[model samples]
Target: MRYFKGVLASERRIRCIEAEIERQQSRLALNGVEGGEQVSRTMEGDAMERGFVKLYDFCDALDTELIGYVEEREAARRTLDCLDDGDMVEVVYLRYFEGLRFPAILKLLNAGGRNMSERKMYSLHEQALCRLWRVIPREHRQRKSVQ
Candidate 1:
């Protein structure tokens, strides 16, 4: 689950970065300068390109970040299939990937009769997160290892 969340987050980040790169590229293309002025403009364009390249590289790094989460999410899904129905998986996917809040999740769950407290809902969230963290790749772990 954590792995799945990490993948979703990484994908979202990648999309944002790509959009920024596209915006920058379009801006550079629209500069419309020529000759001597074009040389100076080209330098500025080069700088922007470098910046975009760096961001692209960062997006690539996210693939590494996503590796553990992918593996863990798959493993968890398999384990979960053995033990329970698909509801919890759906809830986790919607909350983490769709960015839905607890009240939203509660509304979605519609677990009737029992009055679910916000605190309890948050506790469930924490539990899911913990499970995710346990399964996330070493590289994707919150703290970086000292060199």
Candidate 2:
């Protein structure tokens, strides 16, 4: 279950990194525009160089993070695949893969022609997690996260 949660956490981190990259790019764009205020050419060049270097570092970090995220997601997929119960798989998939909250998961399930309550979903989720832990091989259960 922690391993599965780590996948979601990795996704969140990736989004944050991407947002930071965008913010940096916008700052760089703003710096490129000539302003009425006088600024030395050397200072401006140095600032631009620093911005580019920061952007490069962010990109490199993003690439490294993405590779680890992909691996974690793939491992999660395989773990989910090991489950024999359909309902358990769906609940785990919706929670971990789809990143849905319990209420939303219950709503989705009820809408899909299955009658389910929040408590029931919670119970099912716990069972699913336990089953997942049992089904996964001991060596493969080790988590590998970039952060």
Candidate 3:
């Protein structure tokens, strides 16, 4: 469970970093001179270098965290077929892996539920985590084994 949460948090951090890089790239593009090709080339190169650094950091973080997370998650997934519908899995993927917020999830799902607040969303997420826990083998659930 801790591993799952850690994975989710790491993924969210990566997405946030990527979004910042995108915003920076857009700013860099817009700030370039309109007609001077030479000037634009130099600016673009510098911007790309900066963007690369940000992207590299994000990728490194994702790679490091995702390595173990994926292995454990896959192993757990294969153990039990508790997940009947793919929606729960999809929600987990989007919320954790893609770093989407609850409102974004609601919009994406197009499910009408004004009363389905963030608390409910979190509860559902916890349920999913529990399901994953159940799927994982007892030995695998040990702290040292997961690490």
Model 3 worst lDDT window (10 residues): 32-41
Clash list (residue pairs), candidate 2: none
Better of 1 and 3 by TM-score: 1
Predictions ranked by lDDT, top down?
A: 2, 3, 1
**Tens digits of lDDT, candidate 3, 28-142:** 4576622323433466677656655665676676676667667755654453357664656756766755668878986766565444556666667667767777555564464
Model 1 earns a TM-score of 0.45
lDDT string, candidate 2, 13-116, tens digits: 99999999998888887987333334456977778777777988999999999999999899788988777888788889999887998888889889978888
TM-score-best of 2 and 3: 2
Model 3 stretches astray by more than 4 angstroms = 8-82, 111-123, 136-147
Could you tell me the TM-score of candidate 2? 0.81
**Segments in model 1 whose C-alpha atoms lie over 4 Å from true places:** 1-4, 33-83, 109-147
C-alpha lDDT (0 to 100) for residue 133 of candidate 2:
76
Candidate 3 backbone collisions, by pair: none
Superposed Cα deviation of residue 96, candidate 2 (Å)? 1.8
- Lowest-sum lDDT 10-residue window in model 1: 32-41
